[model samples]
Target: MILVTGATGRIGSEAVRLLAGRDLPTRALVRDTSRVPKDGAWSGVEVAVGDFDRPHTLDQAMRGVGTLLLISPSVPGQEIAVIDSAVRQGVQHVVKITNHKATPDSPVDRRRDHARIEAHLRASGLRYTLLGPNLLMQNLFAVAPMIKQTHGFVMSAGEGRFGMVDARDVSASAAAVAAAPAGHVGRTYLLTGPELITYADVAAELTHALGQEIEYRRITPEQHREAMVQAGLPEPVAASNAQVFGLIAEGDAAWLSDDVASLTGTSPRGLRAFVTDHVDAFR
Candidate 1:
């Protein structure tokens, strides 16, 4: 059986759907089984309750599981311990969902955490695939209301290009790696969308999709942090979030790769398509 953590999340849910459709013996590790809504499409899958904060519960969830799709929880500092527990439970193969720019020496706190997990996986002698996904197109949800409310989008990216990929495509790549042979172990895939676009280009797409004159406004990092705080995010999260844009603005996010296409056997969806599909959110 393949065990999936964070089974109710975007990538995890998508992976579970794909695995379930293939009639693969899958176990979805959720915090609360009752919280997991009933999905007739996933009736063949099993539900297991496990929390990463409590590592003792992982054994039952990982029992008889040959491979694990370990979705890193959004909470910082929890992934390494959970991965260690999973390793001790005899998980032979692991597919980790890490950030796109997570290198062995990435300065980002989350990326450092992911690097530690990768090291643990290697030391444990388990087959592992590190999936480093770029920014999610779903982040467009944040600017959606700005477009709908003021017909404008705001960011601190300042023309920095991004290769954001759709969550579905990342899930597809994860599924492929999960089903593949042992060669993928110790390999890291930098998943990205088909096109490189800036926040201004994104605004143009939204303007076209919404039939409105949406404009992109560049802001300072402090201004962006203030905006995020105004939107109800905590101070540290807002600052950290804005800091990433600062990194991108400095040209850290401009690079592109063919990992997604090579893994999923298809080009990733573009920002324009994402904006068109999610235009309702903006409206």
Candidate 2:
């Protein structure tokens, strides 16, 4: 059986859906039964109520699981705890979700944490595959209100290009790997969309899809941090957001790969399609 942590989350939920649809033995590792979705994708999937912080619960959840879909909140110890449990359970493989920019020296705390988890997973002696995806298009939803109100969005990444992928494609890739993990073990794939684009490109796509002119207002990193803080983000989180955005200006995300299509057998969606699919969020 494939046990999925963060089964209620965007990527994990979709992965579970795909696995269930394929008649794979699937179990969702949620913190409680109340968190289980009533969606049809969960029709025959087992529900294991457990918490990552609690090891005994994880051991119970892993009673007969073989493959693990490790999708956590990117917290420090959560994934490590799960990895330890997976080791004890003699799981055959793990499909971990990580960041494309993850590195030991990344300025972004989350990416650094992902790198740390990856290192630990690698040392755990378990067969593993890492899916490191670029910036997900769903991130734009955070600025939906601003776009609806002003016909524009604000960011610190002025003219920076990045391959922003759709979250569904990442989840689909994960499901594809988990369904037949032996073929993917020991591989690290950098998942990305088809093209490199800037926030200006995003705005143009939004304008064409919405039939209204949308603007992308560039701001200094400090200004972006201040704006985020004013919008109620914690000071440290706002600063971190600004820091990552600033990295885009340095072309940190101006890379592309065909890993998504290679895994899912279909091309990932582009910005124009993403904008059209989510235009209601902006409207």
Candidate 3:
């Protein structure tokens, strides 16, 4: 049996869909069963009501599960609680979606948190595979409203090129790893699109997809943080987000890998493909 945490989230939802109806009995841990897609992809999959904040629920979710797909918010306690439960429940393996590289000083605050969790997981002695995806193209949806309203979006990732991947591709790669996890134990896969692209490239893609001139307005990280705060993001969250964007400006994410294709046996979706599929969001 396979159990997926954060089953209603972007990557987890897709992973559950892909894993559904497979020979392995797949289970999705969701706080609300209604959140699970009532579509063909969810067919034959079991639903386990669980919460990371509740240890007993996690234990119940792990009942008779051999492998786990751990995809949750970057809350250390949440993942740690699940990991502890997995150890206690005798789950043999884990497939985790995590930071591309979780260094202690990662500019992305979430990655810093993931670093701690990674350390704990390593110590727990559970066979695990780490799938770390680069910047998700889906993140653009956050600026979609502004793009539609003003034909432009503001960002702090100036001139820097990063291999931005589609969340769908990340989900596919992760599902592949989770489906047959033995060969992937202790491996770390850095998932990315085929090429590095800057925000200007994103704007160009959006322009072509939407049939409208789109703009990429570069701003200082401070300005970006101020804008986010004014737009109602908490000060700390906005500041951390701005810091991550600044790292992009310094060429932090300017890297590419074939790991996604290697795992999923398909090319990772590029910015153009992602923009084309979601063009209406920018319209």
Candidate number achieving the greatest lDDT relative to the actual structure: 2
For residue 174, model 3's alpha carbon misses the true position, in angstroms, by 1.0
lDDT of 2 by residue, 142-229 (tens): 9999999999999999998999999889899999999999899899998889999999998999899889999999999999999999
lDDT of 3 by residue, 80-128 (tens): 9999999999999999989987988876778889999999999999999
The residue-level lDDT of candidate 1 at 152 comes to 93
Off by over 4 Å in 1: 34-39, 74-77, 103-105
Better structure of 1 and 3 per lDDT: 3
**What digit string (tens of lDDT, one per residue) describes model 1 on residues 1-283?**
8888888888888888888887888889999877565757567889988888887788788888889998956454466666677777887888989877655677676666666666666787778888988889988887777777788978998888888889989988888888763769788899889888888888788878878888999998899999999999989888888888999888887878899889878898898878777778888
For each candidate, what is the lDDT? 0.82, 0.92, 0.91
Model 2, global lDDT: 0.92
Query: Residue 31 in model 3: shift from native, Å?
Result: 1.5
Candidate 1: give the clashing pairs: none
Question: What TM-score, to 2 decimals, does candidate 3 have?
Answer: 0.97
Q: Candidates' TM-scores?
A: 0.93, 0.96, 0.97
